[model samples]
Target: MPVQQLRSGDHAFVSYADDDAGREVVTTFTWTGLARHEKVMVFSSPRTDESEVWNSLDAPGPLLGAARERGQLVVSSMRALIHPAPHFTPERQWQRIEEETGRALEEGYRGLRTYIDMHWVADLDADIAVMMHRESHAQHLFTDRPYTEICAYDSRSFAPDVLTAMHRAHPCRLLSRLGELHVEQTPGTVYLAGEADVATREQFLSAVREGLLRTADERRLTLDMSQLIFLSAACAVDLLRLAAASEDHGIRALCHPTGVRILRMAGAENMPNLLLSEVTR
Candidate 1:
């Protein structure tokens, strides 16, 4: 039986002996296991003769209906692994599987499976090491604080391609949580999403500090408060304090639909410097 926890999109390495026992194992797995219900891609050693099983799969059979329901597997050939391999080596194979999966996804294949033939009985250490190295970094976009020149790019003059290149170059990766917080800066405007809680207050304050400290050195700054959710009373006080702290910093805080409502609810709707404007969702 297959591992119940082994999910559909998972990649795996399957190895066996070269004799009849190994062939029978492979045939059984293909016929009754993967080919029946799962989407499985197999990478095998060149020596294995799987043509018979492949041909039989083409004809209508009990497994055919199940196989047709899920995504098809991609079977490839790889070099045989000798026994007693190190742990990290498996990571390379995993990387290959991920790349192939990405390609399949890019080509509009929503589901895929990968199975590699290690051809070795024991390599727990190597496999563990490889698994460790399989960790991946996500792509992210971030604006440079005034203090950091590396992230400083003129968004207005920057061609979309150039901006894309810059984004690609820095790859400012952060947790998905921060992704929702849009901190955009331009010569004449700065759009920032503010949060209401203490944590969000801290983030907004930090952004304000960065802008205030850098505005004279740079130029315009606009703060966009559209989806400004909840904010604590202390947080609102600190936001008011940011207005007091700035001297010559040309930081304009733009309040949109929800932001206007929030400010009105907080009784700060009459603030002179706060700019409430209309913005499309």
Candidate 2:
């Protein structure tokens, strides 16, 4: 699934190695938000020119144009999101964000979604420790709230260590050891793509919750993982937990040959109402 299809309460982190890649990530997310009748906000970095960002989104397309006209799409830059304050306080910045979400709802949008380019963090010589703390705790803002965000970091600019720490802080990741996960719902099945590893533990659990939300207990849910390339021990445990708890919900996880082996070795076979459909090579 595209980043925008993430649950309304999802707080996602996306890392890009290049400018074009970042633009594609933001444009796709903003486009989807508009289609869903949600308000969109974007903060571009100096490397990503504002005009180019707008053009890359297919400037003046009917939907984009209409959204702009309705004031549903708001694009600012790192300079604007962080200026006027002598020092950066994540708390105050976060407050402004919460207020904007409420404003969007009042203006009749379904919800509010924002993407922030974190290149400024490096540019301004900001406090990384404080930023990490803020990112980790931002999860609180999403609980049962119609707010979604993607904090994008430019891999080229951010130190490798910083990137690793950021990944651990965010709940959902656009890319990780698991490639990129797209959890989608069909009539009776929940399909998963990409890799699931320790880095994606929370996202894995969230996917199961999302699947359950869209499903009823009477019918068995078929979780198709044919496209999943890998699964880690930690992620497997979480998957099993959900499957075991889903006894009443009934779940069938279709996995790659290796995934089946992992589950069996992990003792998931003992769980009732959870069937493992192994894919054949």
Could you say which candidate leads in TM-score? 2
**Residue-level lDDT for 144 in candidate 1:** 19
- Candidate 1's C-alpha runs over 4 A off are 1-175, 178-188, 194-196, 217-220, 227-233, 247-251
Q: What overall lDDT goes with each candidate model?
A: 0.42, 0.78
Tell me the alpha-carbon RMSD of every candidate: 17.9, 11.6
Task: Write down the lDDT that model 1 would get.
Answer: 0.42
lDDT of 1 by residue, 34-109 (tens): 5333344554534445564354444444444444444454444433222232333544444544555556456455
lDDT of 2 by residue, 104-171 (tens): 99999889999888877766667999888888888667887789998998888778998999887887
TM-score of each: 0.33, 0.64
RMSD of 1: 17.9
TM-score of 2: 0.64
Task: Say which candidate scores most in lDDT.
Answer: 2
